[model samples]
Target chain A: MSESFQRSAGRKVMSRSSAKELGAVSHLLVDAQQRQIAAVVIGRGKKAQLVEWAQLSGFGPDAVMVVDEGALQPPADDRERAAAEGRLELVGKRALSERGNELGKLDDVTFDADTGALEDLLIGDRRVHAGSLLGSGSYAAVLDESQEPSP
Target chain B: MRLLMTASQIRGLPVVTVQGGEDVAEVRDVIYSPEAGRLVGVTLNKRGFLAGRSREVLPAEAIHAVGQHAVMVLDESSLAAPEDAPDDVAHPAMERNVLGDDVLTEGGASLGKVADLVLLVGSSGEVVGYQIDKAGGGRGYIPLPAQLSVSGVALVVPNITEEFVQDDLVGLGAAVDEFRARLGLP
Candidate 1:
């Protein structure tokens, strides 16, 4: 979410303090509520690491800025790891309204590169804004008709 | 709308060679490393009339694109016997398939049954959440590393996790994000 990093995946990561190279960005952990990049999951399997956006000092064109190499921690915990699997899981899922209505296949979603805010969701033909983002669970992206995002 | 394919939806998907479109193989299993949180590789069943054991494998990198009906690859180069596959392509030791296993609260309250493993989009080798059948008679998902302990039989999660159960995919997806934030799962 730091000033909207457009392309996050595969970016090199360096610690400002130690001037040490950590690793490249493997995945962006987005916070749904905040609608921004919460952290970046780096490394692989057992060595996988996570660096929260707050720990980042800056977002450069060449590398992602971080405080120190120590900020990187293995994303070994079950919860954090679980979130990674679900992050990009939304696209193939279905979109449903509160009335149990079948909307359609969630086609795509746009996220702001500058603010890291999720902009809108393309569900089949209709577009749903982030404000309409009710839940992005394993089953579907549910919307609340009672609270529609203004055009 | 970023199209997402479920494990079940992608199974049986033909692995077609991009060059010739030759049906090199059919995807039989999608292997994911929960620890890595991305898809590691896949197992294939030879195109035969009979149901047989899994053999051929292609690491995630060999994939070109997973379409609505088929999984396309750059070429047949990725097709290799499981034994010859790179270390990352070899199926990890899955002494158990946690698919149908029951999930429980740390103290033994029933949470749900493991329905499916959710693979995030754009994640080449990571797994994100487990779609569970809640004891309340519906489905919900708990983000990975939800501070669960494996008891050889069931997954026991913290009691507070009950609040995170979601009925739909997007909600479940959001729950995982929120849950990770609460637990500070980094």
Candidate 2:
């Protein structure tokens, strides 16, 4: 089979299962060693949740097939755990440069989804090094307000 | 699986046939956008290491061709050297929190200054590491633990020791090798 077909088939098998019954799949946690799909984070209503990678019987193209959600131990807090897992996606984010020094955070990153390549990093509301003057400091600081914290 | 040309192919091209002007300088390096996997600009080593001293940023449109030996430029005169560049700083300085001031190492030594924080991704595109910079000097890649905390401008590392640095934790290659060895990947 073609590579794209194999990928689509895998996604289909995972999606066939009921996300609500087995637990909702927030994201697919990959096992880097095996270079395969590792686990699935399942949410329980608004309170409890569990990570069901080890207990997975199989995975489909869209969802992971698991035996029991009750068999898995739930994390400490639901929302917090979910957010923590979500943050895993931000690894390798490029830090922005300013005045030859790193000044602020790259708030967001846009990439080509199809090729999984990076496009640009949004460096918001941070100081940038423009140039230098005489004896004063040798660097000018400029701020970009677009990097402000989200409300 | 193999459709696009590799960076090495572009780099290996000769400089003679690609026409422009006299031998102003050789193509020193190519800056690629990792996100797009596209060549964005080229760094000309006109004056060798001094190239960094008076660098130039050529737009993608400036490229004329990627033949066997050379990367042809549209106009050689368009290549203007950069001025007023900052001194090279180390890599560790870049990891400071966005709101926090410059960070001093554990020994209170000023390790250059922070210029940026690099997020490391695995081959599968999962964020696996965080790299700190001391300006242009050196970069330290800190592997992401199961949990992370970022408050103000300070980022606290858990369970990371100086030994981690001794494990040949240098570039992306070294970092990935160390991580694989730690995970017992064969």
Candidate 3:
């Protein structure tokens, strides 16, 4: 397994060609062994674009480098279109209750810094505790104001 | 360890109006996973809407404040509970939603349900590609578009008509044949 590509989560990728330009890297494509970054998908512009690691010209504590638009691709594909569509669908999903009440749409999903697994789903106003429920056998419990101690 | 509150605790609280005394909704469900342990989604039960009808899932950032009584929302328009919400809210279309349902043409013709979704999984297992399931039953994958809304249930594709599926979807993923036959459909 390649080890050089192993990267810390939330690492910022800087543009080598453009010194000041930078993009937030949401995920990195590494080998199966979970090491060696084969490619990187930077979340920039209005979408997440895939760029080859070779295009990376530099790295830093706060950012990484790329060959200026060398890794860019024209946005036109049905599958890509559908995939983008799925992302939009996530915005309107109804946050419901066991009794089924309207809360809000999901805002973002946070992951563990080490394992890269799902951590918690951020809801509109409150954060639902989902740690126990995910993975192999754990289940989640629901809490409300009545359950919380008076702050 | 400092007493940390669980995401469930935050989800269950009733949502009262930030402006006054009106109770807007009750916390019905909290959607989260253990991997990240981060609260991602919330289900709210609107008081007036019928059972199962009033639920809405909002992003965690949309929350302006998490008070004792109610959790304030950033965008009120997002709170509107529509009877017919897109797939993302209803059910996760996953791989199954696309495989054979019939990809409609711009003019409204049968194309094919997604046979498989070719997702671009980074070294971190973060999904990057979202290949659509095509007819003729081949492993034709496509990159997932950036604009897509990946939320609770369905993959939301705007401008797409409704007359697509007969039943609601459960999850979305690549085609069954694409996998090595051991992992099965996720």
Docking class of 3: incorrect
What are the runs in model 2 whose C-alpha is more than 4 Å off?
A1-20, A31-38, A44-48, A76-85, A90-151, B1-186
The 10-residue segment of model 2 chain A with minimum total lDDT is A132-141
* Model 3: per-residue Cα lDDT over B1-186, one tens digit each: 011222334555654432222245656654332122222334677654454435565444444444423454422444534244433434433443323434444454533454432221111112222334444544333323233443332344322322222111111233222331332323
**Cα lDDT, all candidates:** 0.63, 0.35, 0.38
Report model 3's TM-score to 2 decimal places: 0.24
lDDT of 1 by residue, A1-151 (tens): 3332235567899989987888987766655545556677776566677888788887676887789988887665554675455443455566654323345777766665445577777776776776776554444555554432221
Models ranked on lDDT: 1, 3, 2
For each of the candidates, give the backbone clash count: 50, 49, 113
- Return the lDDT, model 3, position B56: 65
DockQ of each: 0.01, 0.01, 0.01
Worst 10 residues of 1 chain B by lDDT: B119-128
lDDT by residue (tens digit), candidate 1, B77-119: 8777778877756856573456777888767788888888765
Q: Write the per-residue lDDT of candidate 2 for residues A44-138, one digit (tens) a residue.
A: 33543444455665544455455554545555653335433553222222231111122344344333323322333344643222111001100
Q: Can you write out model 2's per-residue Cα lDDT over B59-138, one digit (the tens) per residue?
A: 44455444323444434554544442211111112332232223334444433332332322101112234344543357
